[model samples]
Each structure stands twice: as C-alpha cells, then as structure tokens.
Target: MKLLKQIILLFSVGIFIWACGSSPINNKNIEKEEPVVIANDSLEYEITIIDIGFNLFLNTIAQPEGYYSQEYLETRNRIFVTNWNIRARNPSQFNDNIYENVIDYQPNIDYGYDVNYKLFNYFMFAQRKYKMTLGAGYSRRIR
Candidate 1:
C-alpha cells in the first residue's frame, strides 16, 4: 500500500510539472509592427496609432505622401471622422471593439499635411481591417 501511494504521488508531481511548463510560441509567424507616430511640433499635435498591421499597411498599401492633395485629404478625413464619431457614440449599434474612441478632429484647425495624411491613411487601414465603410464615394482599390 505504501509503495502504491509513493508511485501515485510521483505521478501527480510529474503531471504538475508538465502542466506548469511553458510551451514555445511560434514567433516566426508573428510580425511585430511598431506603432506609427504622427507628430507636428509646430502645430503641437501628435497621434500615435498602435493597431497591429497598420504600419505594414502604411508602408506597403498606402499611396505616397504627395499622392493626395492636402485639401482632398482633409475633405475625406472630415467625412471619415464624423462617421467614426457617430459609431463610437452608439456602441450597441456598431462594433464597440472597432470604433473604440471618438476622434476629436476639428475642421477649422489645420493639422498640417503630414497629420492629415497619416490620419487619412489610418482611416483607410481601419476600414479595410474591420470590413466597414466610413463614407461613400471611395473605391475599394484606393491606395
């Protein structure tokens, strides 16, 4: 009986050790994209986007910096921001996870070409990732 008890205890200990051991995660499949920081010291503005795959999208998918005029970017941004804010307000109606925060974008304040460009690209990236449309009149193949 004593021998049986010792064997059972040894088995339990081994099981515990195996259960507590950490399994190695496959890191190769994961692409750790860094946060995109859009800042303009002159305007005293900064926006850090930490969404995964955004950096990759901006680098590979988004158009070049000078592709879109500043006015065009601002126009699109206004429409996108308005829709985004509405969705954020009504979480029950929209996906709360996707529309997490309401963007405080002022139409009067000129956030510069850089800020507008980045923000517009972010909106584009979010639309593609979440499979949602902010506003109409934009083609699916916009890059």
Candidate 2:
C-alpha cells in the first residue's frame, strides 16, 4: 500500500513537471495578412469602419455612457495610450492587420452626430498620432 502511494505521488510530480515544461506553440512562418475590402460605395466603407471602430471601443473601453467620472476617463485614456504603445512596438503580438486596414480603407462620409462618438474619437486620435488618413475631409460636422 505504501509503495502504491509513493508511485502515485511520483507519477503526479512527473506529470506536473512535464506539463510545466511544455511551451505554447507559435507558428512563426504564418504571415499576417490584411483584410480585403470589397465595398463598392463610400457608404458601405463608412459603415464598415464604424462597425470595426465601435467593436474595438466596446472591447477596450467597455464603459457605459455617463457611468464614469472624469478621472476614470483620463486613467482609461492613459491605459489606452499604453496599450497602443505596446501594439505599435510589438506588431508580432497581434494576429490581425486591422490597424493598417483602417488606415487604408476608412471611408469618407458624414456620420450622424450621435452615431459613433467613441469610435470617432478613437480614429481621430489615431489620425493625429499615427498620421493615418482616416477620412479627415469626409466626416460630417459634429453637432
């Protein structure tokens, strides 16, 4: 009985060590590719951009309207800056080329005032910082 317990203990330890020794598999040879835009009209392009931007904002910010204080917003903005820095510095860490896609295919359309404020601001920041041409002349007046 003692021998069986000892054997089980050793097997458990060996399994644990083997698991710890394994590393995540990364396929370095697989090249990252940009999404192909097939929209025929500027409206379709604009809508796609808005959709992507809004989704990104929802995933990263995730704050409800009027729920956060000014200080919290500032802190969150700082966190965004940090995350952007990491992405800019380490492109390999990301699998998608959404950044480049946004720069290349962002539409020039006049959006409604309340349609996509958060995404607009995000793209505006990207335009200013990264010199991306994100429909600068095409956006409607923000009321």
Candidate 3:
C-alpha cells in the first residue's frame, strides 16, 4: 500500500513538472503566426480645395423682412468652421472605394423681438445636420 502511494505521488510530480516546462499549444501557435500588415502602395491621400464663396453670397440675401439690418444679418449668418478627417482602405484588387469623414452644419438662429420695451428671447439651435464636405465647387458626389 505504501509503495503504491509513493508511485502515485511521483507520477503527479512528473506531470506537474512537464506541464510547467512546456509552452501551451495555443500560445505556441500564436507566436508562429505572421502578422498581417497592409502596405502603403495602394493608399492615396489628397487635400481637396474648395471654393467656399457661395455661402458668403447666400448670406447677403438671407434675412427676415422689413428694415435692412447688417448687424442682425451678421448675427444670423453665424458661420461654423469645422475640420474633416477622411480614411479609406481598399485592396489592390478591389474597384470600389469607401468614404468616411466628419461633417458639420449651420447654427440655427431663432430670436424673436417685441417692438415694445425691447423684450426678446434667443433660441439658438442647429439648422442642419451632417453636411459632407467634398472640397471645391458645387460639385455633386456619388459613391
């Protein structure tokens, strides 16, 4: 009985030592795998120039009726400047392109005034949402 117990103890210790010395099969496979990295050969980065003068001209005409007010018009024409970053990835064998970028919208102005005693309230909000910026001209984009 004592001999059998000693043999069982030795077998368990051997198994523990073997397990501690050997690397796990999952870890070994992961180490052997080659990392997938895309080369920059097919990537194209471009900065687009836009003719942003149309909005300025449109500003000259946008106003409520009655007396012509420059100050009021300027306040109404609160132009919001925004930056856009676009990223696209496609393989060399693919013909289609993907589009992604940040978008901006004009700020909405809802201010009503009472002629008597100069009572007023300004409710500012966004007029539009997510205007995709395709630089230059009044060009239409289809993707």
Candidate 2: deviation at residue 126, Å? 5.9
Residue 6, candidate 2: Cα error in Å is 1.5
Runs with alpha carbons beyond 4 Å of true place in candidate 2: 17-42, 46-57, 64-108, 112-118, 121-143
- Lowest summed-lDDT stretch of 10 residues in model 3? 116-125
Candidate 2, position 135, lDDT: 42
Candidate 2 lowest-lDDT run of ten:
29-38
- Report the C-alpha lDDT of model 2 over 1-143, residue by residue, as the tens digit: 99999999999999999888745452322222222222434344332343233344444554455554544444434444444445555567643453434222222333322223443456444544344443435134321
Q: Which candidate gets the maximum TM-score versus the true structure?
A: 1
- Highest-lDDT candidate: 1
TM-score, every prediction: 0.75, 0.30, 0.24
Note the Cα lDDT for every prediction shown.
0.88, 0.44, 0.31
Clashing pairs in 3: 50-136
Task: Return the lDDT, model 1, position 34.
Answer: 73
Q: After superposition, how far is residue 16 of candidate 3 from its true place, in Å?
A: 0.8
Query: What is candidate 3's CA lDDT for residue 32?
Result: 55
